[model samples]
Target: MCFVAAVVWSLWSAWHLPSWDRQMDLHVYIGAVRAVGDGVPLYEYVAENGDPFTYPPFALAVFQPLGWMSEPVARLVWLGATPVAVVSIAAALTTRRGIVGRRRQVTLTLVAAAVLMVSAPIQSNLRFGQVSVFLVLLAFVDALDLTPRPVRGVLIGVASAIKLTPLLFVPYLWVTGRRRDAMRAGASFAACTGLAHVMWPAASTTFWTDAIFSTSRIGNLAANGNQSLNGALIRVGVVPPERAAAWLVLSALVCAVALVGARQCHREGHTARGVVVVGCATVVASPVSWTHHQVWPVLAGLLLMAGPRRTRMAWGVVLLVAMTFSVGGWLPAGFARENVRLLAALAVCTWGLAPLRHRAPATVGLLPGVRLVVRPRTAMAYAGVVAVAAGAVMLLVRESPVAVRFETPDHRDEALWGAPTNGCEGYTSTLRADGTVGYACESAVDPVGGRQLNFGGGRGGSSGMVTIQGQVGPEVARLVFVPVEGTKALDVPLLPQPGPGSAPLRAPEHGRPEMITSGPIEDRRLPGARGFSIAATSTDHALLLAYGRDGRLISSGGEKLRMG
Candidate 1:
């Protein structure tokens, strides 16, 4: 019942909500598919949302069938697939040897799927129409299946072909003694690449030669949403030169520990736990693991809870994983958010590292049919592998070119307009790089009765309010805006757009413009006002400035602004 309810709610939300806010990523996929069908260059074409095609060319072929359908139908199909994928993964995980009784397994699958559907990551996946859930399902099924080597390899290979991250599982399979499966996975990946080349040779060349290495095409790596170790380091002021080496060392360590733990679990007949451990490692080691990619830890949490012992520690691990998605923001910024996810993943690995105890014949009903067997050679083998892999990675990082500093691209013409300030409250308008404008405003008198304004025009215009355009120069931009209901419009100029190299303009104090260190200047001067001033502390900051009738600063108020 809960699962049904969740699915119903997801479907309803997908259908009723505005297209711009939800299923946006799905629209990208659909656009990519349509581009392929229309013989358009994949990497060059932007989607409706101004995002370029980021997925591999092979993924286009996979989603190409959807191009034939109408957009609404395709969206419905995509949204509907998420719940099915979640349920399928849950079913696959629960159908294993230790989970006794069909009814109990089904119940657990339904409950877990329902709970996960409402979780933050899954909700984010649905909201953005992302393919992370499908990727998770593919990976989990490939890892847990006791099927023949080729089948598992094909699943992992296909997933990796769609998105590069699943390639991590190939090494994992090899380390776990699934060498044949690893070879097959490589072959399958090669086959997919060959197919892509055959299908779209030009796109294949462009993607493989250029687009694949350009990580900036995705977005800002240090943004808060990026939960990877690299992102965390960058957020805490780690320079790019040191960040690459640091990431290599940290990722190598995580990979070694996770693989060793997984091998130990598998040797001890805990295959499910082993798979989950490797999955957790994949997310942690990736260079850009977004929050939606956290489906692995969620799956690992469910698997841990299903274990026979169900100890306080097991439940605690599950709770920690849950908290990663729930109250993650409560922790301080930088490493704190990344640490929450990392710690949960480490806890899952630790669970796998626990010594397995042999079950008596009577107690075999609770455990899997296999007995707990210890093998020291397997440990030594993994230890040797870890040593070699870590050495290779460190060597590569040391020899690789110096990491390039990342810079935010200048969007000088981009001016965000706030709604007409009516007694200290108004709406904010954002101008996207693609020249699209979005406006949302709320009135001070009636907070609930805010109006959303619509403004049109490309990147060029004049100074007057009648034009409602933006005149952006290298240092300053003049933005003219008209009220939603009123005829009068206002021109607000912002000096020096926000970026690394822009100079800061200080707020006027005592009829003088106080110069400050470099930063963006927010000029909120109106036609007639008493005075204005800007104040800044190490942490807290505020700005207040007034203009005279002749556009000269007559008076100033508020605290003096400080520059760091």
Candidate 2:
């Protein structure tokens, strides 16, 4: 309870914070609900009332209650509650007969902290009003042994229906010779998903058509080019992702084979750590999971340590490194791209199955089953203790000040934009001496280069009137600054053409001529390049130099921002 309390508090402290680089998916779920309440359809082509539903159907269902409350209020409720649920899961699986020893307790504490520190970027989701942990925890409950046979089966099925990723576990259950278990769970899941659909067709329809489609939309995002294995392949070779499905299928098949072997390893009385294998299998089965998504592996690591604490050490170090990099934002865009996230997931799987390396599964379960027996090791094992204790530390330490500074306007703001964040990066808007205020992308952070957006104010939606409050005085005029990425240059194609309501303005950054230029800038066709990039210069000023196809600047003066 103390550990859980600590985690909950940490999350609460981070509540309602906004970050531009992180908190990608978390906002989408909550924002869609707000939009639904505001009369927007789930998957509107033009971002639907400025709320994008880019999550699974079950994700939307989970947010129904949130829709009734204000965004800030809902974020507070979630931040305070979800970590407790996560810790409860850790406790449920690690505690034997509901009794925890000092060593195990410490291990849990460390593991929790480590998760917070390493996956601090995940904190972005929590602060920005996201609900990823719920899905993660729900799926975990499905795999636990706390329920009756029938109830357990349904739980797994329902979890799978919510996020197709959990489907990764089915092969493990089957290979571990839990075929019947899989069927029962599948039945329950089918029923839950069907029931939800029948009861809420609007949400269901939008999820299948819009929300679900949003996830796959990543294939086209330049930011993804840095964050996922799917992106890595296309990036390294400069080719279309032709082998992704095949690779995913192959990985699943391997896990299936491993599952069968792990089952046999269990049946043959190998070792006592099959608990770890089950967890690792879950990770290896998926392709694009993030660090927080891998937290459950700690449970698998604990199970391995419970017996002979051998295999987990190597992988634990590997995992710690993986997570540390993830949270620091030091991880390159290709961090998730290189299958590192998959490796972390695999670490858990290895630990879960470690016991099977020593003894048969039935024998292992029997030993723990005997009410009078106590396992020799109680969490004093070196690696397990470190993992959990580090996690606990994370709960208390708070990420570096830099992390706090990277935040967004608020959770509600992040919620307005889904993944790819769609040119909604940070903003550079200020009232000039001329009285006419200007808005532009926060280029210092490279917001536009990543297919992400960097804008200012408002609920953080692309079109929401950007309202800058407080010290800035009453409210400056709101200018919507959109982000464009990739091409290294932007050609006006046509500049400040005399339009109905659009005005000319100057860019403070380049000291470019103000919107009221004295002379006409040259008009020419824009040169093409590798891709595209976007910048919101004051619509007021004429674009002097346009970035050309060869990555060169063509303009009146020689002012240029080079693409690296």
Which candidate tops TM-score? 1
Cα error of candidate 2 at position 43, Å: 1.8
Evaluate all candidate structures by whole-model CA lDDT and list the values in order. Answer: 0.58, 0.43
Over the full model, what C-alpha lDDT does candidate 1 score relative to the true structure? 0.58
Task: Name the lDDT of candidate 2.
Answer: 0.43
lDDT of 1 by residue, 30-76 (tens): 88887767777888766644467888889888888778899888877
The residue-by-residue lDDT of candidate 2 on 141-232, one tens digit each, is 65554567666656667667766766755654554556677777777667767776775678777676655643332223223313333333
> After superposing candidate 2, which stretches have Cα over 4 Å from the reference?
1-9, 19-27, 45-51, 96-125, 200-228, 261-287, 300-311, 325-339, 346-495, 498-564
